[model samples]
Target: MQGGAQLPLPNPDSTPAVPVSGHSANGAAPGPVVQAKESLLAAAAKARKEKPAETEAEKMLREEQEIMRNITSRKALKSVMENAQGISYTRNLKTGWKPPLKVRQLSEDQAQDLRDRFHIIVEGENLLPPILDFKDMKFPAPVLRQLASKNISRPTPIQMQGLPVILAGRDMIGVAFTGSGKTLVFALPLLMLSLQEEVRMPLEGGEGPVGMIVCPSRELARQTHEVIQGYITAMKEDGLPELRSLLVMGGIDMRTQTDALRRGVHVIVATPGRLKDLLHKKRMNLDVCKFLCLDEADRMVDMGFEEDIREVLSYFKAQRQTLMFSATMPMKIKAFAESALVDPVTVNVGRAGAANLDVIQEVEYVKQEAKLVYLLECLQKTAPPVLVFAEKTADVDDIHEYLLVKGVEAVAVHGGKDQEEREAAIDEFKAGKKDVLVATDVASKGLDFPDIQHVINYDMPDEIENYVHRIGRTGRCGKTGIATSFINKNQSESILLDLKHLLQEAKQRIPPVLTVLEDPLEELRELEKASGTRGCTYCGGLGHRIGDCPKLRSQNREQQRNTKDYFGSGGFGGET
Candidate 1:
């Protein structure tokens, strides 16, 4: 909090850091349910493509589309949706997005707060008028002095930790929740750095993105770009160069992005994969960028874009100050930060999943057969507009179908649906045309539905990080959100342990169910045998081999004990 003068930049060798995780770079098989959905989709695709005749271009496009269909990460899906240009192609590209805001732009008051924040950092003291740094940060004064303030009074722990390092122009990795204002950690520095250089127009040969942000998802990309624009534009009208920004995601026109790049912009926010495609084709350049950022880095690994991110990281100047931010620090992201940051400072804003603090979490252990009834009952009594999450596209479909049959107006969105359908469904939900949106994890990250009051985990996520992301969809922008999970009899102790850690950190109430259950996501052997799969290790895997087939083995051990009791003790066993 003291001596805010522009902090010194890190050693020259440092910078251009990106949160790089190998999770983004692999070829892995789909989850069992996802595999089943793929099978269902293959039949659906076959039926949809009834016409046998096709041009070579058409065939190639279809193949591309099929490959894209297999990618479910919202960011990956958005990359594809943003690329479709033809009418059907465009519709096909629709990875349902309703812009976060439509009416108002950044207010002058908001813009001034940004300027004042920068001044406070650069001078290590408030200019002329003079105020305490702690006080300035506490109430909206510094930022609110102007009209239309985008006031964020107090800096979160992460910001307080990294603001000095960023002002110093040092590379950094921030681990914090989605709503923790991690965006400003690097953004403020980059804006200040931009002020040091001469503002210029786009150059010829269609090159150079001065400030580029590589994000895991298009929704994040779009949102990040808009946030940057808001901050930069506010600076511009106040007498600085208007920060130009271009959005490059998966789905829209490549030509349009190319044109935007060629026309030149001050900053570019993009999805790693699509941005790679553009860069490989020499459609854009990173040579001039003095600053780079990789946001939602942990999620990128979840979406499988590590290689793309690495490749893109290579494009930036080695010394461009890099700022990498993520919600969690999994091994993959940690490795990326190690490789990408140059002796960078690591700032974690609060506990990584601290947003869980304001969230009230509950888990219900119910029979799968009774899931629908329980879900409906819970919503009818516990809350309204509960965001139900499923593990697979098929589950979303089944839930949607069942909800409709029960006269519940529910909407569903997944990777398998075309962009238009996804968009239509999302729009309907936003417009209140639908009461519940049954979705896969794609809806969990970077999408804001302010009125979302509750989140239902129909299928608990294998990764606890995902659980954090799902709960974030609600309780955003300073509001509280509730999350209820449905854990079946067969689920995992690991999940409970993870939940315990999250709950302890977030200050949320612990459900008594955490004490009684194994992994609900796990299947019982009996259930699996009956279903011709395997009983869930959680409930019994009917035949589904998950992780390493640990649940099934446990079930087998239980069976042996039963056999021992009958044969040795009762002397009436059928077999020893």
Candidate 2:
């Protein structure tokens, strides 16, 4: 490599000519040095005159540079150490997160191949380390034990890529199917961070939680809390620190949650609404929170919780590791991730807005009045442990009532229900006491209920993502399930294109009604052409039907008048 190059020096003796009446003194023009000097001066002047404004990216880059400079400064280092309480915040914590066995630097081709293989596309630095199995990246003994106990010998696609990113302490937005074990992707990291930092359960009214997991629904919140507790139990068995995890959500007593907060929990799994309420009341503080996980993040954004999520994010003082796990990646989610996550590594396991392939989808074009009849028929054919999704709370209530009157064991849950009622309904459904659970979109995402034999769409969801989520209730964890959609004209047209695409992708049969919109028949087109016009069908004349033609009316009127006049005269002559 060429080390360094030197600039050509100007002739030392080169001098500018003294112009005497547009003539050089020595009868020679200016030397190259003088020309070069003049050019340099002119370029300097032009640059100063045309200085461009700094852009946002440039500003951020400069800020990053400044931060790097400051953090390495002696004074800044001293301040950070003082704040660290004499414990250095090392790059490698005691979390048992070791670097990969052998880091192979991937070429561009290799990275592209890997990305294509996993449907993974990262936006940040190419910092992904490879791991062939769960054992490749060494986890804590207790965590590994819990995994073994659950017979989780291998990692899923999301888990495989997600664990490395989470372990490396980089924010991520994981997009996978509903049953792709998204819960554990963040749960394992949360446990690791807590254990590595030795975060203990806070004393009564002493400090706030160190980790916060915000879910979209109460059942999911409780479910996540239970999973965390499982890991906590394993940690205790391993003689690690005991952690307290709380499930904070609405439809429950605020006093109880406040008391739990006062008892000094290490982790809080909550829904956005209740969590924001607690934040407003000053009952919970997230200043010390280090791990923030948003499960079913796309659903949260769709439910109009963006502002609440942003407000919750405002409470964090120090920089926190944020992870978002969503089943579908909507534009809203992508935009939210842009604002919420910094250089997040996006792990998309498959195509977005696609339903699980294991689900068998069937669409019936039934009118609104006959939906109940069809639903009843479907219920008769389907087995128990079914989930029927409605678009409205009133519909859910009506279905629940109708089912009860029909002597079928069923329960209802919607946004209008109290938290206790929702919990009880979910509990009954989970315990198999109730074979059918009628619900709104509340239970669409993040609520894990295994053995859901069928997911019935009593009313087609307005959004495609909701439809995916509705059907996603079943077919979880590699289980074969059926999804029956009762799509009428009202829904069939608006969602016909998306529905067809989804069905095609899932390898399900597309109904005839959904096809005409995509590929209309020739006969149907001719009939539509005739019916679509305003002219009479018989004569092809505008503004009148064949039965009410003006020419025919005149002929009939003339005949009637002439017959009356002539018949009257003949009768008069005969009488004379």
Candidate 3:
């Protein structure tokens, strides 16, 4: 199992406890399913006795409602499942072979014949099955030449799948290991559609461009923006009709984004929140968007941006081609696809949630207190170009301080750090002035620093899936990478377990040691006991899941009772 940080504390609330795989709160195996029912009742009673503000309870209820709303939204889910039987097509153009060239000395007629032959072959080239190409390789030339001047010569598998689908103007869902060039998958297509449109249509003044790429993080949006810029640069080089692009995301002044959008961009890559903010105000238009791509679709779900995604899509016509790309496809991703796409082509480049092929993975079982020691050992051993991902802001600070004390050049990046510090820290890391960069999720999104050899998860992610995102920082651009995590005695190993299942499914081997690892359930129970309430697994509440909740049950029973009363109490149920 991948290692995880078992939270030290519990929530103090009257909510049913989550049945973690570890021991129960009393340091014993959970007595029984009956005991679970009793504990929830007890917790509920305790919460009532505490008589906390109704306002807090109300807030909690609202958050829960929103969470379900986010999950239940059928758009992405339906779009995905409806297409789940999956559509298949075949092309025999060529596999593991390049297009043939004949530059050998030839007569003019032969040259013309060769050129005609090239066109005929390309026009008639039968493409291969999607699954085969996804297993390996990058994009074709028209896309590569555009990427080359941008200095990106090789394509990742995600790009390979996405580029084709995007150009075909079909809905697409791309899932692969993180840092597998997922951005280019959507961005290149976005550029192709727009730039190609600029060429095909006499933009002699068609209302600007007709595609948009939306991302959740500012850094990611910016990374995507830069890639688009590279493509636009290529377009200009090719002397194609001029294409324009812009970035719209948070932490940046809206005035700038508003002005850029007002000036008109064919492709606007923005964060969901900010983009929605613009859309609601009638400043952004999707009425003409022929193509749309959601980069990091899973992050938007995790960051709770479903409403924004829906809101943005609501502005577009259903006929628009939508593409959603994520490093990993969780349930939320399926839901997002349902709401957004159509009978689209689906591409699975790598086994979902697995580490990058370039990244070597490892874990060490250490005590929470000893996490610092192992981190130091890793820093000392690594040749200094490394990144450290901490699960919390405090951990980021502590690790940064420790590294500083060790005389290792290091800096931290997170939400609490001022914009200047954050930017400076990223710049320093990018400039190679910092030996190590300690960060939170902020660094995990869309960073493209080259030569980074190690990604250390200082703290394992609470959501097991985030493991893919955090470790994505290294092993990018065809480079080899390594990821190491420190696991303590009480930390949750569900992540490792989940990862093991995912990897083994992909035909990767599981470590023999993991087969006999400590009990995850017991560890979770201890942590939950330490925390006032077992962190709510249902809606991530403090103590309970949705199905087991008393309030929900009461609502159901009340609903049934009211139905009987309305039916004239034929003891209606009996009569029926």
TM-score of every candidate relative to the true structure: 0.62, 0.71, 0.65
Tens digits of lDDT, candidate 2, 1-576 = 266877778888987454435445675765433232458889998998899977553453355435334423322111232334643232322234556635445566764676667666555665674454776667778888898887788887778778888888877888888787888889887877766555444245636687889998888889899889999999898888777788888777899988888877778899998898998889989877877888887677556576687778667666677788887774335544655555667887776556788789999988999988788889875689999999989999999999999988999999898878998999999999999999998898778888897999999875566788888888887778899999877763435556775776677898888766643223333443544432222212222323433333454455455454344655732322
What is the lDDT of every predicted structure here?
0.61, 0.73, 0.62
Clashing pairs in 2: 251-419
Error of 2 at 381 (Å): 4.1
Using TM-score as the measure, name the better of candidate 1 and candidate 3.
Answer: 3
Query: How many residue pairs clash (N, CA or C atoms closer than 3 angstroms) in each of the candidate models, in the order given?
Result: 59, 1, 31
In candidate 1, residue 243 scores what lDDT?
Answer: 51
- Give lDDT tens digits, candidate 3, residues 30-127: 65443344578899989899996655444554565576565465544322323354422232111123312332233546533533432211111222
lDDT of 1 by residue, 1-576 (tens): 477768777898875443243332244543322112347879888987996776553453355334333422222211222224311111111112111131124354653365455332211121112122323322122223321365555565556545545655566677766565667666655655554443444344455566778887665676667667777666766675545678887777899888888766667788887889988898887777777788876667656576576667556543466677776654334544555555555665444444445567776778888888888887764455668999999999999999999998899988888766877888788788889999998788767676788888998876566788898877765678788888765566655656654664566666776544354434333443444422112221122223334432454556565564444645664344
Quick one: best lDDT, which candidate? 2
A best-first ranking of the candidates according to their lDDT comes to: 2, 3, 1
Better TM-score candidate (1, 2): 2
Deviation from native of the Cα of residue 526 in model 3, angstroms: 31
